[model samples]
Target: MALPEVSDPQVLAFAAELAKNDGLVESEVLATLEEASVQQSILDAIARPAESKAWKDYRPIFISDRRIDDGVVFYGQHRELIDRIAGEFGVPAEIIVAIIGVETNYGRNIGRYRVLDALYTLAFHYPPRSPYFRGELRQLFLLGNDRLAYPIDQLKGSYAGAMGLGQFMPTSIATWARDYDGDGRIDLWNSYPDIVASIANYFVEHGWERDAPVTVRAVRDATARPVERTTLEPLLSVQQLEAWGYAPTAPVDAERAATLLTLEGPETEDWIIFRNFYVISRYNRSPLYSMAVWQLSQAIARGAAGDRP
Candidate 1:
């Protein structure tokens, strides 16, 4: 195919920077960028992310019976691999499976957008987060063939440029993707060991506490004061929240640092979320996404156990 028209100064500057800082060929970088077409559909997709939906709407998208059942079957098939990685990384195996299930439906539909086009469109066209996507584009170029088994131009992933079964962004893959099968290169697409371990490694890197509770339903008393959540970090202690009249329905250490989240579910739902819940947010930065993953993980575990009969 003919090279795409490349007149954008930002794209030109990016090519130059890659050539100077990363020692890549400027002409080759330019050619690669030129080959990437700006995808309006990708721009549209990013504009309406699933995270924009309400909790009640978002939960069913990922937490369906089919997804839970598929996760159970996937776990059974990869039990040895998942368990070994989970033990090694101190992250629950069901959480790992749930992440994959939510991201790509057990690797069945990772994404359709060509990674090059997706990143290019976002980096150049999407103004709100252009800098971030530009940085990802830079990382994509930096991920040499050695680090990524696939050819850069041919790779396919989500509109956000997250690749693989786990839907990892370019920066995340660079930082946490592993060669678990002990092959010379990291392959998140076809390698089961690498995909599972990389996700577990990401959770461990983000401070997932072993055997710690993710979240619990909370009850707000009649006199409870509304607490605005300004951040996802577990800022208030459980005791402090209780003093404010929001208490966990289940027992937990009074002194443990936690955060209160109120979601619009079938009925308004309140949750006292712990540090592990914040770690999950590190993966997607959306409370709805984190909650779906956590709930899906629980459902998957239960389904897997019940499938034994």
Candidate 2:
């Protein structure tokens, strides 16, 4: 296919800046950007992310019988490696698998849209987050310079440009991805060890505490009014939530910070999510996603114990 003209002044300016900053050949940089086209479907997908769905609908998509079963099998096959990685990183093995499961279904589906097209379309056309996408576009060029495992135009990822098994963005791939196999390269596509270490490293870097509690069954008093659900980070301490008559079913430190989450449904389930839960949310910044990861981790554990149907 012939390259399309990137006539947008912002895009042309960015291309020139990237060429200057990265020491990339200007013509090649423009040629690559010209090869990228605005994908309307990518725009459509971005408009309604999985995070926009209700917990009832979103839960079924990731916590299905097949996914839970696959997670059980995945954990079994990678037990030695996962365990070692977990021990080394101080993150739970189930959490690691659950993160991978929630992200890509054990690397079975890592999206299909060309990463370059996705980033270009978003960086120039998506107004709400154009600045963020612009940075990712720069990171993409940096990653492609002898760092990307595959050909630059050949890498496929989510519509928003998250790549590989853990759905890492270009910046994450550059800053945190490791050569876990010691093969002189970091390839997230087929390198399980690299993927494992990368995911664990991401969590560790973002403050995943060793053996820390993630979430707990929350009980609320009638005095408690539903707080805002938009907060993904831990904004309230356990002590504060306790004073508000929302306490965890399990005992935890009063000093530990936590967040309140209500799974929107007919009945409306509530949870007292801890700091670790907030750390998981750092991966995607959605309470629904973090909750699903925690729930799926429990389900996989149940299946491993022959308790899941």
Give TM-scores for every candidate, taking all chains together and pairing residue i with residue i: 0.96, 0.93
- The C-alpha stretches of model 1 lying farther than 4 A from their native spots are 1-5, 307-309
- What does candidate 2's lDDT look like per residue over 1-309, in tens digits? 333476778977887788778886666778888788899999999998888988889899999899999999999999999999999999888888998899999988899999999999999999999999999988988777467678778899999999999999999988888889988767889888999999999999998989888988788888986576567677888888878788788888988888788777667787888778989988988888898999999998899889986
Specify the highest-lDDT model's number: 1
Candidate 1 C-alpha lDDT tens digits along 1-309: 333467889998998888899998888788888889998889888878899999989999999888988999999999999999999998999999999999999999999999999999999998999999999999998986567878899899998899999999999998988889998878999999999999999988889899899999999999999998988899998999999999899999999999899999899999999999999999999999999999999999988889523
TM-score of 1: 0.96
With a 3 Å backbone cut-off (N, CA, C), the pairs that clash in candidate 2 are none
Q: Which stretches of candidate 2 lie over 4 Å from their true place?
A: 1-6, 225-230
Q: Candidate 1 lDDT (Cα, whole model)?
A: 0.91
Looking at model 2, report the run of 10 residues with the lowest lDDT sum: 1-10
Q: How many backbone clashes does candidate 1 have?
A: 0
| Cα displacement (Å) at residue 292, model 1 | 0.2
